[model samples]
Target: MYRDLTIGEKGKDVAQLQKGLRSLGWPTGADPSGTFGSGTAAAVRRMYAAMGYAAPLTASAVTPSANAASDAAGVGEGGEQPGSDIEMGRSSATPQPTEPESTVMLPVSEAVFVPSLPARVVSVPVQVGDTVKGPVITLARGDMTLTGFLDPSEQRLIRTGMKAEILAEATGVHTTATVDSVGAVVTPGSGADKTASDSSAVTPQNGSAYVPVKIKSSGRWDKKYADQDVRITITAAATSGAVTAVPEAAVSAGADARTTVTVVLTLNA
Candidate 1:
């Protein structure tokens, strides 16, 4: 039911055309003046181009043969190529059917403004301004596993099948997971140790190196939080089950070759 109108034409239809273009993110400049002017025509071409209905218009882009079609279509210069079915000067009451344009869809590179090709983002590769081949985004496909660092001492308390609580800070959602694997203790040097005279002078705050822990998330999570931080808490042992315990630093070998605690346990109640 669409009728084609061209430049210098005045009607409410022209105003409606301008309004539609504005809604589609194409600004028709300062006026929606009820006349098909150059501005409205240019916006129409952009709309057509975005929808892949026509080749994009550019000052130096359209060929001479294409220009002739553009002129006849009543679309501004550089507009979509007119179809072969359109009659140039027919004044019949019944509208003529037109063949769809036969032009190939413009390449996404010409239509899309992204610096990289459309792709699933896996991880950031090149930094800003770095040149890349196809696909700006990295692609990844798999079930998600949680990776985190745990104190070497804490790692010893965890084993496969241990339940973990993962809290998403953004949504305040708590998700349950199970320990997948606890890697061997890794004594990664603290940053300050790299520049310190004595590497031992800079030690981890916990007095122990860290170990890698992998957990499998058991609940669904929004992909928006992919590669983001989450709080992981694992309950490996119950304190209520312990009848006696001593801090690591408090126990030492005595003259009798027995471990002695700084303070003796006394049950008063």
Candidate 2:
């Protein structure tokens, strides 16, 4: 028997499995990339339905008719005899309102199924023209996150309000972001260590811990830059300020602890 297919698996085995499903008229969602993912799992379920197997049941799968029948069954077992006036009245009573169709209906993609336990797979081992059963691929889904590390000094200079300038070295495109947090505990090292920094300035040869920094950006960022090494600049520092100077001898401290500067004006006749 061929080994079971699962998510995170790749190579000729996955491609072979995908090709087999396609021959059976199942859609794998995309061209066989040799990587089993959610799209592949969906195609497997389609195959199950094709072989007269129903998709696993879920709370959302209960149909309106099934619910009505269940309710009727409960009433029938309440000691009501057939054709009795009480039973007749109950039957003729106003029907209970059901949830709006829009609220109860689920999209085909969102439907969750629970197939029989111990899972079933194709009885016949995967072959040139044989079909298989059970999940061909497992799936894991979650939101993406961006994590980075900063030097202790750099971390102290950063705060939540600081705007981050992200530069893509390949495309020279820029994206704007804001600091979300600065980690409390220092980590021994981070992804940035393995990567070459934009600047060749001196760096600590001995491994130095870094504070984790999380960044939040508005709108969408090009997925092409994901995991690709990029440069981040903290642009929230004071770039400009007005300056005035007074001689120290002309300044005095008041009782209130505030500094006082006396400017003498001489009037000439």
Candidate 3:
């Protein structure tokens, strides 16, 4: 009997196993190759089902029968040849051929992961019939929040609850948002934090430090704007009524540590 070929095994033997499965009308999900991955394993399961195996097969390895090559040559169980379904008036005394030991391919159970909450697919790096080596897809959960980084001077002027205007230059979509929070700690400008949306007008060229800020849209945001760079204008301070103005020369500080503005009154008699 040939040695068992299991998952994660590579090389010519795996390739041969893939070919054998294809001959049995099973799709391996990839071109016949040396790697025995999930796709190959799934194909093996399909082969088992076609062979009338009961549910919950125990073995995960493929054990080639001593006459594996002959079986792959179109000779099936009970000495039945491929495409010769006509049982021409055979004699009743004819003895039936015993099933071959090597033709049986066993399947092992594999675990599947499922997410609890619904999510949006951000990206897929691999396609059908392609060999999967690493990450296959990216997912985004819940509503998207915007994050941005600010330089030291800019951080000092920003505060939570301030109104901000978000502009996407490419689409010219304008949306109103509010400052949800301001990060307490400072981080290097080069390492822009990703926990929030990045809305910087221009990235720092000299690698200066920056503070993280979180912003939330006033309403549901458009899905098309996700991951796109945007410009943000924040209203740090504002005034509603009239205010007094003074020249720099008329203002002074007294010894009492109080600010005084000199008023010059001219009377014409």
lDDT of each: 0.60, 0.58, 0.64
Question: What is candidate 3's CA lDDT for residue 90?
Answer: 35
lDDT score, candidate 3, position 29: 84
Candidate structures ordered by TM-score, highest first: 3, 1, 2
Q: Model 1, 218: alpha-carbon shift in Å?
A: 2.1
Q: Which pairs clash (backbone N, Cα, C closer than 3 Å) in model 1? A: 122-138
After superposition, candidate 1 runs with Cα above 4 Å error? 1-120, 123-135, 189-208, 239-269
| Candidate 3: stretches off by over 4 Å | 1-118, 127-129, 189-206, 239-269
The residue pairs that clash in candidate 3, if any, are: 65-102, 146-197, 147-196, 147-197
Tens digits of per-residue lDDT for model 3 on 1-269? 14445556677766766776676688678644977776777887786677786423233434445454444443334566644442332322234355432322333222212233334666789899999898777766666767666776777899999999999898888888999898854544434443333433333355556666778888767876776788888887779989877999999999999999999889999
lDDT of 2 by residue, 1-269 (tens): 14445545577667766766676687678645787666666776787677787534223222356556566656656666776755755574435555433111112342233222222222333456556465443432322345556777766677886788888798787888888777654433554544433222123445577666777777555666654566778864563677666888999998999998989879998
Best candidate according to TM-score: 3
lDDT of 2: 0.58
TM-score of each: 0.40, 0.34, 0.41
Using alpha carbons, what is the TM-score of model 3? 0.41
Model 3 lowest lDDT segment of ten? 108-117
